[model samples]
Target chain A: MSDMPSCQFESRPRRIVIGSSGVQTDFCSTCSVRPNSICSVIEPGDISRLSEVAVEAIVPPGRGFIEEGAPATDFFNVTSGTVKLFKALPDGRRQITGFAAPGHFLGLAVSDSYAFGAEAVDTVRVCRFSREKMTELLDDFPKLERRLLEEASNELVAAQNQMLLLGRKTARERVASFLLDQMQTGLLPGQDGNGGRLHLPMTRGDIADYLGLTIETVSRTLSWMRAQGMIEVGKGYAITIVSIAKLEVLAAGNG
Target chain B: MSDMPSCQFESRPRRIVIGSSGVQTDFCSTCSVRPNSICSVIEPGDISRLSEVAVEAIVPPGRGFIEEGAPATDFFNVTSGTVKLFKALPDGRRQITGFAAPGHFLGLAVSDSYAFGAEAVDTVRVCRFSREKMTELLDDFPKLERRLLEEASNELVAAQNQMLLLGRKTARERVASFLLDQMQTGLLPGQDGNGGRLHLPMTRGDIADYLGLTIETVSRTLSWMRAQGMIEVGKGYAITIVSIAKLEVLAAGNG
Candidate 1:
């Protein structure tokens, strides 16, 4: 399987790379890139201030950026890689609250700390904006402030959708929905416009826990999908999407 | 039968007064009130600013504050009323998204429009903060901004919990959990802290849609609960909770 992307998805904005010395950062000129953060909404003046205060860093697989209840260090935006944001129960169970794809901002808080923790699901590269700098930028750039508000609102909607899924759908339906989402989100590769096949990142166990089902059930469903030829599986957890239309039927329970 | 609350719940907040063409609404400060809406996070100074910019109004029974895609109005805090926030499919099926209790804010947004439609299940009163005033207040008051973030986060968690219910739990368990939540949230009056008993607000039909079950199934379960002496219901929705502990067990799937 190819670890590198076949073609660079242009929608993903390139990181504004500041040299390791972090000195003399380009705090000037009109940057046309639609930033994935509250930075996007602020004017040039606010961007300069944020650029001055913000630090950029890289996070590798299986590492965490934020922990629940900890005073937030910096608000984050993923330039690359996947970040799993989750909340923990004292009893050791973990519910993945969300996954931050590229262009997604990780932490944008109004308080001292965060209720959800952020962990790197894969090798991640990020740019950090301290709360103070971000706040200053927000004040200086009213548009940026509104964007943050918008992001929060959108987050609420996404959360509500997740709630509907967790609170209402059957396990099979959840798995089906998850599979279809992977296809649409470009998380799956190898589809040549026919939506034929793609690779899966987490294991069956992860899928089961995420959907609140046992691994055995997840295995059974995959086997069923394979038998129906709605899917064909290859080595290393790769699945060919033979018929998304049929899978949609299965997901909606008509099947 | 009485709309007036009989018992004053300690540690639980009563609804705030909606409209007072006055200077500041310091309901959160100095008052023995627990915070509900994002406004609860604001200090006295900011709350005063918020009050200056907001208007209070009462909503009659069965009326909605915002419809889907309507131009943004004043963001709201539900001072009094039972609100059912729901999303309806084109096919006319409705999913009860959330129930807004007292002290919780409704219609607060970072966008120009509301994504879901909100209607008062009963006569409702709300503190209305116009879009212009709200943006100004959020910009000026960082503490309030933080609270808004937390509120959004809390809403996010609630959505995730719903996902678990909708995607995994059995029909019986969903209804059971819904009942448990109502009791805990005071949507229905809880057990007298002695013998456990609860009154339900919406009917079995409502419960069926919310839990993704049929009305007949909901009715069957209610009958089952009665047979086990778990509850007793009389005319006019006089539902008596017999065993909170046992109900919790049932909700957890022990039943």
Candidate 2:
């Protein structure tokens, strides 16, 4: 991990006192992302067991939590905000493999070292679990293992799609596909949807890295899309899909 | 699946009769790749259970057995030969995601349809199991599920590395990295190794697709490496590594 900032444990109390209903709530119980995360497979009765091992931490914007090639001791589940997962070469060239959103799981490698580094794209909150504790949980809950396999399978599919994009897709097609995908992720549960409006957290450089394009190319493409009336670029990290049909045509490689 | 030959069942008997000792051997028990594959996690006593659901089939060279966007009905374990997994654009631009060698597991998607297509690179043998049957095995054998998770994790790591290669590496670096990876895979158990000599199963076109380069570029890079005394391009698909140190330097982006 870098010296930027570590994932510091939240200073709030682990147990919260409910107002007047006399109801007791634990960390995992009130977590908004649990329903969409791997924790959803755990029964309500066993949620306390999960809470016992999980430590909620907050990572400030642009802070790196996981370093590539470092010891794989911990796993993370994003509870809020976006995280960018990437692999860098010795020459300092980088490739952003994926942007992990809330409810996304990190550190799924079988190797003893991490294959990629993870940094907060925005102010992020995550639940951390040690490898030994995670193994114990998997042994105790078969459903959790199955759920993880499902998650890994889904990630593998996404990786394949990314390979196709990086290897074959045109710059315009890649940008359009990325916008559409962001829209889809924004529509997921626990996310605030503002119709076609999107609040992108990463910079244009990050977008270029993810799409295997230069920053100038990304900027030019966005300008072209705006001029074509396919999208409306708004102030500071905001973009609106003006014409979904037109973007879809470009994303499908027909533009 | 395409109009090419399907993975047809082998004509050999399921049970082999040993001479003199009258010992009975099932298909999985005699499988050459079983010891290194996910099947290794299954108890010896449960071998018959696996054999009951597995159907051995042969796929001829260049046969497409798994089609992109087709219903994913079964999972396969390669026992011999190599298979290329790929995704194609609507305009017919293809990206060979990764090559699956012996002991590799395939069709791990959580979706109802395959995310990519798979084709045999040479005469290949595989053990096929229906998704329902595989699920039953996983339910009955927790270790099997754990093993599958490990396989998926390893594959995820490989996919990330491939994304890095495709998105960031130069053409020469990409080819160098590919040669080193092939050498490592060749060194694995059940694969034939003749010093540093490699009998590449796929064509130059496939290599170009996998490395995100054109056929001309791939050829030019190989010739450059050969002239630099880093490798020796032999007849047909043969290529011998002349100096691993040189290739490693190039692969690490220092050449």
Chain B TM-score of predicted candidate 2 relative to the true chain B: 0.90
TM-score of candidate 2 to 2 decimals: 0.92
Lowest lDDT 10-mer window, candidate 2 chain B? Answer: B8-17
Each candidate's lDDT (Cα)?
Answer: 0.64, 0.86
lDDT of 1 by residue, B58-112 (tens): 6765566667667777577777667777664343445667888777777655557
Q: What is the lDDT of residue B203 in candidate 2?
A: 93
Off by over 4 Å in 1: A1-34, A42-59, A63-74, A87-94, A107-114, A128-144, A170-173, A187-199, A219-234, A240-255, B1-76, B89-94, B108-114, B126-150, B164-200, B205-255
The Cα RMSD of model 2 versus the native structure comes to 3.5
Judge the docking of candidate 2 as incorrect, acceptable, medium or high: high
Instruction: Rate residue A104 of model 2 by lDDT.
Output: 96
Residue range B1-255, candidate 2, lDDT tens digits: 134345333342344435467765566887889998999998999998998888777787888788888899999999999999999887778899999999999999999999999888998888888999998999899999999999999999999999999888999999999999998665434444333887788999899999999899999999999999998899898888888888988998864
Measured over all alpha carbons after superposition, the RMSD of each candidate to the real structure, in angstroms, is 8.7, 3.5
